[model samples]
Target: MSSPEQRAAAILASQRFVVIGTTDADGPWTAAAQYRLRPRGLYVESDLGSRHARAIAVSGTASGVVYDSSAAVADADGVQLAFSAREVDATEPAVRAILASRLPRDAGPVAELDDEVAAVLAVPTKRLYVLEVERAYVFDRDAWRSRGTDARIEIEAADVWAALGRP
Candidate 1:
């Protein structure tokens, strides 16, 4: 059987999008954004004016879920994350590297990718955000089987990174 860390890593790596939840003075908000996963965190692109983005900017915190929507109810599995989030400058080397890694092999040269990223970030409203995960949990099927009730098991962030073959 797969460990919780393995399950979380699989779900995170395979999922293309995450529904991020954030809060502001008015109330809570959720928005889905396509994501690229790295050992450090999950990266997403959004507009600075977006509700979720604005909320993150204010609170510096967010929670998100990544799951297979196509899965049957009985077989459903997902990762729940609590994170510190912030807008990152696209010109930063780390940001550029993350963006470049997500591109297809044939997408083009590194310089071209940097140009594209720059063009997008140049829009006053657009920004790149990173969610640095603090805590994570995965659905525990073994617990469900044993107790006949849904349950989640906390997986260490280090374990999740290790599962991804990172230090």
Candidate 2:
């Protein structure tokens, strides 16, 4: 049987999509996002006008989960994470490099997105947000009558990104 820590590392490495839940004046909101896993946490790129970005700008907090959709019920596993999001300053060379790595499918190359063209298209400059994971939990799929999962493990990797080197 695989340990939960191993399950979490696999999830973080393999999953590309996550649903982030946030709060607004009305109530709770959720956004489906494409994310990249880094030792720093989950790195997600979004434009400023996106509701996801707006919400993060307002609250700087969110929660999300990632899992493999193709797995069978008995074999399924996932990671639940609570995190905070902060905008990355694109002017910094290191930060811009990260942003460049997440180019939009609809957009042309970075050089083509000059300020003039970008402004006319309402293409808000890509903003990098790191989901600074606060709490991470690993679980498996089970029957309704059972405890949510047989082996619940709290992933403490968020403290120092130790999960990155899980062996």
Candidate 3:
């Protein structure tokens, strides 16, 4: 992990829904997506047949906002990332391990997915996608810290991780 990666993970842990923005020839589109953080990217499991899924597949590029909305003031802490997204090999060891670990925690949307498929409709076609950032900026109250995919910021990722660990 790196500083940007650390910041990204913190943002993910602190927030549940991400605003996903994409564009097509006719116009721009956006949707709120539930996500989980991975070492190198973020994961979103969505209906395979939906427009949200189709947009990501067609463009591969996306920008997302993850914000801690419980601020005392009008507008506050958040992070925004520009990234690429694609369906992942769910069986890949790393991906599998990460998903499994988060499952027990019942993190956000993962909880809904863990339900018995005993729903009105048959189990839907849902696939996990990896959203890897090309660049990102973190807004901590009033200040901003930014880094490219290279994480040109000087901080070590490990330090950031340790500091942000949940008490």
Clashes of each: 0, 0, 0
TM-scores, all candidates, are 0.85, 0.72, 0.62
Name the lDDT value of residue 78 in candidate 2: 76
lDDT rank order: 1, 2, 3
lDDT of 2 by residue, 1-167 (tens): 65666677777777789888888777888888888665546777678877777888899988888888898866777788888788776555546445444313222467754552334334447777878778888774443227653664576764325545522
Q: Estimate candidate 1's alpha-carbon lDDT, on a 0 to 1 scale.
A: 0.80
lDDT of 1 by residue, 1-167 (tens): 88888888888777788999999999988889988776557778898889998898898999999999998877889999999999886565755766765423113576687686777657877788888889999988777767778888888988887776663
Where does the lowest 10-residue lDDT sum fall in candidate 3? 144-153
lDDT of 3 by residue, 28-94 (tens): 8888888766544467777777676787788898888887778644334556777788865434453
> How far out, in Å, is residue 25 in model 1?
1.0
Relative to the unseen true structure, what is the Cα RMSD of model 2?
Answer: 5.7
- Name the regions of candidate 3 deviating beyond 4 angstroms: 1-9, 89-124, 140-167
User: Candidate 2 at 47: error in angstroms?
Assistant: 1.6
Superior candidate under TM-score, 1 versus 2: 1
- Rank candidates by TM-score, best first: 1, 2, 3
Runs in model 1 lying further than 4 Å from the true structure:
90-112, 143-148
Question: What do the candidate models score in CA lDDT, each in turn?
Answer: 0.80, 0.68, 0.60
Clashes of 3: 0
